[model samples]
Target: MKVLIVEDEKPAARRLHRMLEQLELPVEHTVHSVKEAVEHLSNNTPPDLIFLDIQLSDGLSFEIFDHVKVDSAIIFTTAYDEYALKAFKLNSIDYLLKPIDVKELEVAVNQFKASFRESGNPIHNKAQFQPIDLQQIAKLLNEPQNAYKNRFTVKVGEHIKLFATDEIQLFYSENKGTYINLPNGRNYLLDLNLEAVEARLNPKTFFRVSRQAIVHINAITDIISYTNSRLKVKINSFTTFDLVVSRERVKDFRRWIEG
Candidate 1:
């Protein structure tokens, strides 16, 4: 299938592109902002599907609809609250939260294919797709943001453990399990996966440095240059494994660390 990605964050865009490639669905193009997306849509043939981010660098991605007519099927990629996603759910539109899981992405793709087949639309026939109410979606997503998580609860061999977000130095996935590392050098396995854990944490405080790990701003002690344009981040009391920021994330990581 022909695919396009409209995402502001370079790392996120690249990650999504990689995931699509893994699914054997090669993306045809990628645009970073609403302006670029509008221009691309006006100038080139629209793809069969678009993996679109809600917020772009210039504005909400919905603005692109004002300038161009898009007929491609869309799957939203967003960090917005579930309440704000009512428009999508009501419309039978699909969405993937930030730190999207590959399995979930696959399910979404399969659903899209099934819908396409049911509609009997040819590969180049995008006009058969229904139009979406972009204004309504924008209004819903513009509502007040959801509260960030302040603490987490985990089960430890029949015992329960609760820890505040401030106590966390880092969260990492290992052997398909997610664990939180504390400043006291203690580790607790969380019930939620890294994607779910990341969705709850405040983006201003915690940044996902790589696919495997998320680090809190308060936990950072040193930023060292690493091989192949990546970065090595040192977290307080967490030394069991090295935390290397992915090359795709280095630019954003620098911006996050600066703040």
Candidate 2:
């Protein structure tokens, strides 16, 4: 029953620690932010289980997986009621939503103890550390019911033009701002940023390829291996483009391609 809690919020971390005490689980470590968690685990022993929060002050919680081998079970703790929370169950992952329900908490804990504590068969038993699989994770994303972008009419020069999801080639952050590039090779300046567009996109159709690119499904004509662990994508039907996938984004890109 040794546990490690990784959460950026002090109040939330303390509260989780208090609950762990009530559950009679020994708290081995409580580190805030991904950097601290990495340092702690790299220099010391890994814990039996981890209570992880998705968003941190510096980066996403998944960054920890990139740096270390997490053999222990994880229970995602987050305020996200949608995509992030949905990321659980897919990989045999558990989650405790913010303002965590006591009953739900108890149930998650019981399930954890039951699965990890005892051997089920006389034969060889496998450890239940489920890795985060992307195809499975894709199921967690909410699909666009109608289309990628909602209906919108905007003034184009002098006349009003209507736009739909399929009309757009991709969205990019230029000069630290967002803009939509249409299939007709026209770039429309937008106020929204790349991060803002990601959650709005249909996970099946649009992928956040890199920090600056939210590429359209149709836009991707071909993908070729690039230098290092990156990729070079040929965006079909584009005005002018030179988008290169960063090494860090390679994993998500592969997952999106496989999905």
Candidate 3:
């Protein structure tokens, strides 16, 4: 299968190229920076698959998607752990944590071949490929080494107000936008998406109970057992929707609350 490698480090890129060569997969091209990668994809036909690195020289490789539409499937090779889980949720073949292992690369390649064989036409199934959410990636990568956002600024009509993170009870998404609720019964729209906002907040103080809500530890006044072995969380503020811990996140939610 035709493949392209977009990696910034020369030795790493060359090593990956050699690995693919050993496997006898046709390596179409190898580009270093996001700019060159974008330029190549703009002029040439997209490869069947791309072995992409998350952080490139100019910017994160996700920027290439912003410039052009790519039909190729992707296997992200990166040293960063934060975005690896999120990257797999996209139409990615696999995420290979770096200092690439030969066996892991082989397995990822086999997975791709299996999917490609099943799909019959890789290019036609491009609709399933979701572009990497760069905003969320940026938030994750820029997480504070020793600090989190202590306060946030929100615009209210004609004025901007600042609220300490401790003052906020919960952050939730509704009508495609994120909003934060306060103890004083005030709600303000936030500029960042729920995922981005969650990444910035201190995980110890806040827990993402569901895709729709990130609740502060102080906000949860009650946790009632709910249907399907899920949990119904009651916050200080009255919410129109039931704040339920999603089934998948239930275990972690329990650990967070108990701790």
Checking candidate 2 for backbone clashes, the offending pairs are: none
Clashing pairs in 1: none
Candidate 2 scores a C-alpha RMSD against the true structure in Å of: 14.0
- Across 1-82, the per-residue lDDT of candidate 2 in tens digits comes to 5688998766567767887778777688899889998898788776767888876777777778668766666787865434
The lDDT-based order of candidates, best leading, equals: 1, 3, 2
- Per-residue lDDT for 82-129 in model 1, tens only? 577677788666788765767889998887778777884423233433
| lDDT, each prediction | 0.79, 0.68, 0.77
For residues 1-259, write the lDDT of model 3, one tens digit per residue: 7799998766668878998888777688999889999899999987898998877768777788789988888888865544444545553446776557777888887777887888855533346655445567656555565236667766565466778889899999888667899887778876455765775689888999888999999888999999999999998765658999999999998888788
lDDT of candidate 3? 0.77
Per-model tally of clashing residue pairs: 0, 0, 0
Instruction: Score candidate 2 by lDDT.
Output: 0.68
Error of 3 at 99 (Å): 0.4
**Model 3 residue 124 lDDT?**
32
